[model samples]
Target chain A: MCQLLGMNCATPTDITFSFRGFSQRAGITSDHSDGFGIAFFEDKACRLFVDNQSAVESPIAELVRNYPIKSRNVIAHIRKATQGKITLENSHPFVRELWGRQWIFAHNGDLHDFHPRLSGRFTPVGNTDSELSFCYLLDKLVEKFGYHEPALNDIFTALKEISPQIAEHGTFNFCLSNGQALFSYATTKLHWIVREYPFQHASLIDLDVEVDFSEVTTPEDRVAVITTEPLTHNEVWQAYQAGEMILFQHGRPIKQAMTVVERLQREAKDPSLKRVTKADQY
Target chain B: MCQLLGMNCATPTDITFSFRGFSQRAGITSDHSDGFGIAFFEDKACRLFVDNQSAVESPIAELVRNYPIKSRNVIAHIRKATQGKITLENSHPFVRELWGRQWIFAHNGDLHDFHPRLSGRFTPVGNTDSELSFCYLLDKLVEKFGYHEPALNDIFTALKEISPQIAEHGTFNFCLSNGQALFSYATTKLHWIVREYPFQHASLIDLDVEVDFSEVTTPEDRVAVITTEPLTHNEVWQAYQAGEMILFQHGRPIKQAMTVVERLQREAKDPSLKRVTKADQY
Candidate 1:
């Protein structure tokens, strides 16, 4: 299993604070420490930093923690090397350009035997199942709508329709963004929180660090943070129900859809595969 | 025009020393200032950093100058934006994955009225002639050799043949690499230097910096540095010919080819465009 962190905000917000806590999972707090990667979007352009080294000690990860590269949409991952070798190419938070917009993606859970036929349009450079899924999704998007890019809602609709097929293979929790909006899907574990006006102090669960958000943010600023687990202990983080997909924009969850996890549970080819339960609900 | 810099070496080497001097051209030493970018390859994986801000003042550039990220091949660019807006998407040192390998490219010259028919296998993320050229080259390479990546010599042959077709539009000096070999094509300006066992002292032309290579390198270390102009004033740099393509491997020029600049000169479709000359040789 890997860990994912995503942020979408109304204004450009520095993720250094959240990243510092989330990155601790790479080695210090927990052990998902095969590799780490992060993508910061400035408008349609993205500055992606990926290293095969552990995030706790990687110089690039240190740079990311210290430098405040503000972005409306950001995705990060700390890998545990479930499916690929620990190489720079295998690190998560993969990037590709579609519709003249750079799309970034990061995955958190493993997809067992999930190999979809790629259209050779958006091929994976690395041999990771995560990257393969991303490529397959992109190819499907391109296939559904030719040359020109469709609306975001249409894309979400297409993604909603196709995500279950991949999810059926195994746990498929992922965060994807095109800088305009962030789309997150979960068949297993995922949590989210929105920090807006009247933001309060929060303490990191992994580190003995606390931050008073009021001191650093304007009243108009709003931030949506999604992660495998809640980074802060005090904040009321909302856990995604199994087989739920949510679209986050302007620091809030605006839309959601349900998958066929229940239907698949009723008609299970493998009884042990459907691991959803009441605990998965928010 | 933009300024291009590339490094290919026998061993992994940090480029902070060269980058410090080269980045100075973004604002302080010379003005190619619109944006800047650099791409470093670690095996088949790449770490690409681009900024719309001038390298002299960009914090990311400062980080690059301070951090010792080592690589065997690197491509850097400082833009004097002639074709596109000064945006991150339009920054040079564009990257794309081809044949499971990340291909990096940076250009120093322009291509006028040059829009080739894209096969949709590869597309430009940004609106730059440099990026278009990179895409067209990749698409053509894929078309010529489907699925499998070809040999370095075959790639050089294909590049040697395809380069002139793009160059016919305008000046098209560029550097491209796939972590295996560095391929450089020159129509107007490009210079290269190789530092080996018997290294000597060299001083940057743009900065008051000097380094004795013998103290920092081993007998086995070999490095080939290519730029739009010689980065160091004291080193004997070899300039690329008017229409020449060189494939550099293991820090040395291993193969070379000549383009039809002379033929274009003989049959000038536009009298104003034929700028090929004996002065181009060094």
Candidate 2:
């Protein structure tokens, strides 16, 4: 229904290279071109740019492509209008403030009848199931911890408890970030790649563009890119299994407890359960 | 200490011409150049752009000058950093969502020892006295009317009651809008002008730029421009009295009851009370 792109890094890094190829999907390489949005985090704050126009034609997207905005965490989305109209208010990724820090969220798949009760300060300004879900998640977080912000591990635990329930309705792939880390979950399609020391040349799958990461990055620079689909031809993009979730911080994934999806798999002998599979393994 | 520019129009209007001159104050004609931000309201939602870079040199600012984004209400600020560090988070105008509508605010003056007790959902993300005052106002609004948004007249009354209290600490000139109307308050420097049917040529004070308004506007179109200083040299501007607040809607000022400043001035027989006056009549 839509597409997502996210980046987490050990240092402040720009998304121009990956965004160039990813944005092409909005109108050129493929058509998910109803609207587009991007958020670049600078510490606890972020600059969010959104337009109802196709990314290929939007002046704001052109600025995003040409200007190199460095950030530790970034999230972007190109919409195909699965649930909402093609209006500026309906564009993703949507942003809300929590505990005095900005939180950004973008969704890639459609959910059927997935509106959860929202009883907190967070509310959706647009009429989209994506924004509704984001508000619900934020409400759940506030419900669990009140006005105080919880630690990363506590947040991951809360998400692990909540993602599977929503995934039951339909495809629930999403990327969320609050400047500190990126949290991603997939029920259908999602991929990620980490670029680290001794990086090599990579070729874009959509356009005739190539970049040698070694030339532009120091040995200490590390970056993790997560997207709905692979954007490069040469790099090994790891595909996420259905109902799987991952948390990325400081350029790499930190090992955690089994996701609710995995836990449900261990209890899959129940007749009411459906098997969650990788579908496409890299 | 800073500068503010706001526009409320009867119809959607692009602010390129006025912004061209207003932005010059960031680094060219004057130097309130710690950072700058602008917000353009498209209905209940808005597009907010902020940068730590000076408006004269920032590429984002350059894009703003060139691209004609239309909006009914707009707010812009050029910061001098009286209280916070010159970071992206400290830039104005600041935005927050309440009752599913985005509220935008920008301040042109400083507050001294004006931290009010905040016991509500709204919180300041940056360490600026201006943002603290905004959060306090929003918190007060929520306190008065829980999750439901009150009527515009009620909001005006609440602001009329609260603005004078904050002004007691220091200069408290500000412009606030929620896409419905623009609310402005001043204790020192602020001016406003309304342009309607009879349009004529106007020249900029900060730059050698001139434009004939009749060439681009219709008789039905009306716009009200509010700023710390008049941007155009040819147009007549009206200055605000100390502690005065005005509510603007449909490109015209709606008649309101006496502001607290006027009330205090009428009761100025007390030896302890100081008189508030319009220092500049024109």
TM-score (all chains, Cα) for each model: 0.91, 0.94
Segments in model 2 whose C-alpha atoms lie over 4 Å from true places:
A256-260, A263-282, B255-258, B262-282
In the predicted model 1, the residue pairs found to clash are none
Give the alpha carbon lDDT tens digit for every residue of A1-282 in model 2.
999999999999999999999999999999989999999999988999999999999999999999999999999999999887898889999988888888999998777877687774877888988888888888888889888879999999899877776766677899999999999998889999999999898999989999999999999899999999999999999998776788999999984344654665566667465555332220
lDDT of 2 at A10: 96
- Model 1 chain A — which ten-residue stretch has the worst lDDT? A273-282
In terms of lDDT, model 1 sits at: 0.88
Q: What is the lDDT of residue A148 in candidate 1?
A: 81
Cα lDDT for residue B214, candidate 2: 93
Poorest 10 consecutive residues by lDDT, candidate 2 chain B? B273-282
Q: Model 2, residue A65: what's the lDDT? A: 98
The fraction of correct interface contacts reproduced by each prediction comes to 0.46, 0.48
TM-score of chain B of 2: 0.93
